[model samples]
Target: MQSAEGTTAEHTAAKGRPTPKRREAENRRRGPVAPPPRTQREAIKRMRGNKQSKEERRKAAAERRERMMAGDDRYLMPRDRGPVRAHVRDIVDSRRHLMGLFMPLVLIVFATTLVQNIVVQQYATLATLVLLLTMLFEGFVLGRVVNRRVRAKYPDAKDRPLSIGWYAFTRAMQIRKLRVPRPRVTPRDAAKVG
Candidate 1:
């Protein structure tokens, strides 16, 4: 039918070709650009690709752990990596840390508390507290010394992480055998490094 503007309904509905059915047009827009899976097997095959990628990631992580344990350094945590941190580790490892005695002393004190003698338990508890305070003081001193040495060695490097001192102190507190990236220097070798 003709309208006042001299346009017909057919002309309006037919731009280049007949207007597609609304449902068919919508479906076309929503359809996958990639070819649809032809069968359940194809869908499963695509899903299995994710498992393979995950397996690859797991293997990579295991290899990284192995490298870290072997002292490759590249895979070491940020707190443990870098030349200055390594030097700090060496210095702490070289000396006998009073903090290292804290654990054994604590165990002894704990054992004492298990005894029947109340007097002995009191003394043991007191001694344990005192020992802990002393160790804390010593750790502070150790951290300061480590920070000084690191600053001296790397005066120009100002981007050191804030935890460097704490990292050094903690490593110093650990028994030599338990320290990861196992101490490269002995007490005798420490003097030579300095």
Candidate 2:
């Protein structure tokens, strides 16, 4: 047995200070502390939150998603950020993207092949080939235009011409209504393409 001032084997070092006083705790003390929850529902509710906090978190997340989709710079993905990329998106969005029809044409050609008629299949294949060639030519022209505009606006910018041009081309391939980050300017307000 140890004396009052003597240390025992189980004794550890002191914390060096007393606990902090909380005004909120003093104000909240109505009686003895509440006992632990008893029912399963009560316990699970305590484990998560009474639904209010969970709902608040979910609402906040939804708001953040909306802002991200709205092209807020702070919430934008790395690829979509910066003034140049925003300009490219706006330019692409405001134009009627004929490439948007590529998917529909592909489906149409696929359906035509189901006819089993040699003449129909031949015409469908020829049309597809012609469309592909036209799309490739148009893509090249769009790239040139995008690069030229970017270079003109940001003469001293170190951005790669091919990358910016390719980015513009991809954005232009998307349907206006389906484009992520949504369109800011309508076709009526579109900048003239050179």
Candidate 3:
């Protein structure tokens, strides 16, 4: 048998010139072959007589209705029902806002403590350490508050920090201090049919 590229297996019996495989391959590579076109009226009638099963028809009709309502009829595109990323962004934004609110007050307290110190040079390293710790603490406090509020609102939210360690401890503190209720939808509500 000869390959499409004209290489032949020696075991194959050659025809009068090239193998049958080579002739078939040459015909396939030469051009595209199209089936004959059907008459539009005949095609329409045939399609009308060919009915889909009731369930399939119902599903198709429902999809068509949805597309019509959405008003983008170019294609049957999938709908995105989740707002997870937006919720995460909201948490990040709230964290940043609260950080902005409390950072200045923390800095002022640190500055005052450093200013009245008996030995300025002696406390420089301690002051630096305090400042770093304060910034980190502020970030933690604000992050916890934001995350707690978000988690309470969206209990089933994926990628949320669920552990009660470190940041989770701070979240508990924020929940306690601010009296923020961790309101969540029940599992039954989540299991409800759409």
Candidate 4:
């Protein structure tokens, strides 16, 4: 039968510190394993394969150090965030993409539905051909229109009109429809209150 103080002292001693062997064993389990010579060789080979030229790396590092020391990062002029316009070619490409995805879906549904319908079955071959041609024509027209609309607002290139493809479609679209919601005019604040 030990005194309360003695038991408390014993408990504290037990919990106070880990034995050296126990600590070493824990460390060994959690520690990184040394790689085999083969693995090391492979890793080195990979690093060499991916390695940039020493001179280029040194130059890049020097530039980075210069930037850090200069501490004028914010003072450095921001890049021009100008809009890029869409050209005719882009409209055509986007139209092609749009139609390519949609037209096939329409054709599949038409084919499946018409394959069983008596009236459609009678003209199935001709109907399919007509659908295909229609889709192509629609694609081209839509693409052309899109190109025009996109070019009208964004302009293919800021300096040159013929720079090609809308680089700023999202921004241009946002600009096209600028609307600030205004508060409703009240009778109390109306002109002459009438």
Candidate 4 or 1, higher lDDT: 1
* lDDT digits (tens) for residues 1-194 of candidate 2: 57688965566789998865796568567556757999998888886875779899899999887998899999888888988888777777766767877778888998998898999999999989987887778778878877787788778867798888888878877766777788788887674532
Model 1: per-residue Cα lDDT at residue 166: 85
Deviation from native of the Cα of residue 22 in model 4, angstroms:
49
Tell me the lDDT of candidate 1. 0.81
Global lDDT scores for all candidate models: 0.81, 0.80, 0.48, 0.43
Winner on TM-score between 1 and 2 is: 2
State each candidate's clash count. Answer: 0, 0, 0, 3
Q: Return the TM-score for candidate 1, rounded to 2 decimals.
A: 0.64
Question: Against the correct fold, how does model 2 do in TM-score?
Answer: 0.70
Residues 8-60, model 4: lDDT tens digits: 33343466666579778887889987565477778887667557566678888
Clashes of 2: 0
Distance from true position, residue 154, model 3, in Å?
1.9
Q: Local error of candidate 3 at 173, Å?
A: 20
Best lDDT among the predictions, by candidate number: 1
Worst 10 residues of 4 by lDDT: 175-184
TM-score of 3: 0.28
Best by TM-score: 2
- Which residue pairs clash in candidate 2? none
RMSD of each: 12.4, 12.5, 17.3, 28.5
**What ranking emerges by TM-score with the best candidate at the front?**
2, 1, 3, 4
User: Model 4 Cα displacement at 169 (Å)?
Assistant: 15
Q: In model 3, where do residues sit more than 4 Å from their true spots? A: 1-82, 94-121, 162-194
